[model samples]
Target chain A: MGLDPVKEEQNAALHKMRKRVIESIGRNMDLYGISLSTGHLYGLLFFADKPMTLDEMGSEMKMSKTSMSTGVRTLLDLKMVNKVWEKGSRKDLYEVEYDWYQTFTDFFDIKWRKSVEANILVLRKSMDEIDKIANEYAEDPEMTDMLQKDKAKLRDAYAYYEWLDRLIDTFENGDIYKLVPKEPPAKE
Target chain B: MGLDPVKEEQNAALHKMRKRVIESIGRNMDLYGISLSTGHLYGLLFFADKPMTLDEMGSEMKMSKTSMSTGVRTLLDLKMVNKVWEKGSRKDLYEVEYDWYQTFTDFFDIKWRKSVEANILVLRKSMDEIDKIANEYAEDPEMTDMLQKDKAKLRDAYAYYEWLDRLIDTFENGDIYKLVPKEPPAKE
Candidate 1:
């Protein structure tokens, strides 16, 4: 079919709109520990009409195919994108996760959960060591007092991390949505 | 008073414990867009007995005074630390905010709220532009449909941001603490 003027103009408008939002997304992605360019790449895929190949993405993004591959790999690892098998296509195809709420959950669930769990592990190990030292130094009143104070502080910190662990659980288990509903209330 | 042997040993143990936790905090600092060293700086202050001067922090961290100053500035900007005046002391002193929950709220309130507000602004501007274009092309039924679809998508994205704005308010106003209590429950 011949190119229609109105259709062409409409396409341009849509592209511009998506580009504006994508740039904003790119700029703010550092909060999520993602690079600006990677954010742009994800935004491109998000607005793509269909799953994109690395070659297609590279050309559109004006990035090297190697870079595109790396970015896509990061997105895939974060569950921000999915790899799909396209019938009759030899190359890998990738698509963005459309649900922003799910994207938020996945990103936090992975990143925060890992950090929280690692810190908790360290806290427990440190507390255990403190307990051993406290027992060994019980005969010395000054040493016992110091150990007790430090142990109490560690216990307080541990409580905070425990609460954080539970907070991460809310995200992972979808309980956070109950408190902060995924859907925004209807606009006034 | 002279340092007794038992007291010295206890101090060593406490120092080691703090160091371990500090190192872990440093490793995880990237999640908050902070340098590992800055995280270490914050941890040092967190475990400190009193507000420290830049020189003292530099010596303890084995960092240049310049680097310590920069790190302290960043921590200050994040509200992770505070500058305090000490009577009869000429040097500036800084201390870490002790409440981890408040630190969490402040860090996220500043970071995520700025991001959410910025994204919402762009979404609004883009939607307005779409509306202008749709009105300009009112005669074209196809263009109107295209604009409407794009506008809807932007609206959906805006809703998410709006929800995020409210979520940030929870952090700011401490409503999130109600959902995820700052203190962990009493242990059995």
Candidate 2:
């Protein structure tokens, strides 16, 4: 059967638009230090009408099998993509996870929280050492003044990390969406 | 005059404590993707009683002149450290700026807000592309369904970035501190 001219033209336009969307997703993820291939894979799966086999994705993205597998593994570890088993098809197909927001928050939550906790431990250790020095120099007002100042700075650093912990909690709770300005900036 | 035994012991203890603080700062900065020497330089200046010349800092930190200069320059550019002129001293001396909180917030504010803005642009671009595809596939209900779902995800991504921009603003304003639990968590 011959292809309809109008339908063929429409398909071409749709393909171009989908390619643009995938490129934009890859670019945005690059800004966050995520690899472009992983972003592109996720974007492709996100808009696909059905799950795609790794072979199909590799051919469409022009990536080698090795590269495609590596990208898929990364997305899987990040919980941004999942493997699917198609009926009567032995090959594993992949699709983008719908809870992308949760995926991102979970990744950052573990990362930033661990950092903050480590900093807190260091702050405590430093503070203990400072207290010991302060006690040894109890009679020297001059030395005490210097130690006190350092103590205050360490306290501030501690508080900063503590704030980060709370902020991350707020974000994970989904309450942060309510805090942002909803309207787009006014165009002159 | 001979060194007093008690005073000598105290001085040694204080030196050890200072070194520990510098190491902790360096480690924490490493977590944030900052160079270790730069973090150490800032940490040293933060606790110093007076501004220090490059020669003094380099000798005390046991760093090469070139390394000292590079680290100091990084801190200066970040606005976390400032150069001071000492009377009768031709060499420039450095001290940690008092507005260290602002310096840190400003650094993260620019970094994260830029990322969020870039993501917003990508989301908008992707959404526009999807809209065009939706129009072209108007007659195909299946294609339209997929396009609409992708469009919804893009909108969610946009809102996620919008939340990040606002979160950064709150941090910059220093209001985030109020949200954290002021009391230190009790040891079990």
Candidate 3:
């Protein structure tokens, strides 16, 4: 056999490590409320030294182009992956483009903010309806009191969302980013 | 007909509002990564003036007792609902037990912390595998360099999770809670 024992062992070890890292990426992505495929695609590019075309990704990941395209599109929208066109080649290549901090900030600023805004609108709409009923029973103090309590609860829920939105802004824009020492302090 | 037209219109309007509020609760719970049924059950209790028995919730929500029991159990586990045994009644009644802030903090403290811990373990396992591979390729400068870069990325990812854990701790223990006025300040 032409195989060298040491080289074979090294190849096997690297393959196993890559598999573990890719699976970890999948699990982490699920935790972040993202699809596993998107995470896996990113993991591949992250571990690779150069960009990969869609066909190569599909073959390596055992995924269809349709699924790969969808996953890649989501990563693109998240600004986690960048697409490139080779100077002399017709195929497009994709590579990891975002840092962890950028990904975290974007997820909070866009996805979390949208969810909070939607919650606020829902609370306001419900309060409006509750107000209409409370007014209809203006003469019934007990009924009005009950409605007022319900409305107040809704307002409290709305305020909580507002607080969460502000917290995200503080996390993204304030000292939390600075608190994390991105680079090691320079030697004196 | 026994129906009073004006009363019927008022009831219809109130019913629609209740439906909207319940739906909003379900939506919000989804955002918090809880089940829709749990949210719906809590929504019903939140808007009710009196505590409800399991049978009453099942009937009102058009759900079977089995589903209602499961949903109620989730809310009970989260401390969002409490069971009250009426003085003269044989049935157990359930009522809303937490303010919105309490619910949010509990979710982050318990659920979110657990998620972060799980993610940290995954990253650690991945880093270990990468370390093994890097050590295997110690003789090859190019391979070691690539592996070192990969290991650094994993460490960066690990650091991000650690930062997120600290962020949750800050939210739970820091002045954010004190900063948020639970109730509006009284007029001077």
Candidate 4:
């Protein structure tokens, strides 16, 4: 008797929009590379009453079993979602974090740290090889000038990324959240 | 005649180093969800005196022509590189920016506006849906409590994104570049 008439109509509208969004995000998966189809996977997970399995994500999207496994792994890496293993099922079940705070943490753990570290390793290796070559052509005036500019460009970007890493680490581990609670205390 | 052997040789090293850097970037494209083999594409372009063609990028990597085409399109969208039409050349020519400032400007131009707009649209859709739901469930005791929490979270995130959009918008039309140079001047 108390079901909202207005809300029921709005839900009807929302359902249509949500489906379209799911399709668009799915179509975009090709652009991101990999056979991973996140739109359908995440869409089903979001509206789910309980955590879902890799098999469920695969079957619903008509995606291959292998691709679904990898896609879920990537999603777990990104923290866009999470894995919840049921005691009786003995299989991995996934759930999306509706909370923004958790979402940001997921990004921090992967994109900012893991990816940054990997990039730096590659850069250092490349720099070492370049170092040897530069020593060989030390007498070329024009080439020397060009090389300095490129190195400085790379060095500056590296420095910037380092600064960002430290900044995010500080805040992410620090209690910045303590200062930003939404609810102010009610005055007596 | 005016060059130092040690310094000039160091510059030579940087050139080689950039190739390594570019090569590494290409190889790890999958890690970042990039569509193309960024290493192969950039590795070829890194030292090329002239721009390359779609056929060249594909043939060099031995990947499918269709995959190469899609990859190029994604790279073009990011503006990390650009397309050039050489005089007396029929096929499209492409090049990557060696200069840091030019590259950053290109990236900002192509991405800053559109990415923010897309994110804002996502937020607005979610917000509007929540509000619609909120109004309908305003009188429900438990729902009203949950709605209040959700609204505050949505509002805070929306405000932060709005501020970020404004900050990036200031960079448009070359206003910010003049006011804030690539490297700020030393304070007196």
lDDT of 3 by residue, A83-141 (tens): 88789978888888747777777767766788788878888888888888878899977
Per-model clash counts, in order, read: 0, 0, 0, 8
Q: Cα deviation of A20 in candidate 4 (Å)?
A: 3.7
Docking class of 2: acceptable
- Prediction 2 TM-score vs. true: 0.70
Residue B187 in model 1: lDDT? 80
**lDDT scores of the candidates, listed in order:** 0.82, 0.71, 0.73, 0.58
Off by over 4 Å in 2: A1-97, A136-146, A174-188, B1-13, B50-104, B137-146, B174-188
Q: Please, what are the lDDT tens digits per residue for candidate 4 over residues A29-96?
A: 33233243564676556554468777876776687878778777777766767888779997788887
Model 3 over residues B1-188: C-alpha lDDT tens digits? 00222543556666677678778767667655567877888888887767888898888789999988888888887778888878998988888874766766766777668867876887788788878877777788866776677678779878877877766675577545544444544659
Q: For model 1, what is the C-alpha lDDT against the true structure? A: 0.82
For model 2, residues B19-83, the per-residue Cα lDDT tens digits are 77677767666544467777887787877767888887787678898888988887776667888
The Cα RMSD across the true interface for model 3 is: 4.9
After TM-score superposition, what is the CA distance of residue B121 in candidate 4 from its true location, in Å?
Answer: 3.3
DockQ values per model: 0.59, 0.29, 0.34, 0.18
- Shift in Å, residue A38, candidate 2: 4.9
For residues B1-188, could you state the per-residue lDDT of candidate 4 as single tens digits?
A: 01233643545445456556666556655433454476457655654445778887777667787876777777767665678977898988887666534544555456544545664676578668767876887687655655455456456655645553554454455444444445545669
TM-score of chain B of each: 0.87, 0.75, 0.79, 0.68
Scored by lDDT, model 3 comes in at 0.73
Deviating ranges (above 4 Å) for candidate 1: A1-15, A139-142, A184-188, B1-14, B138-146, B183-188
Model 4 lDDT at residue B32: 38
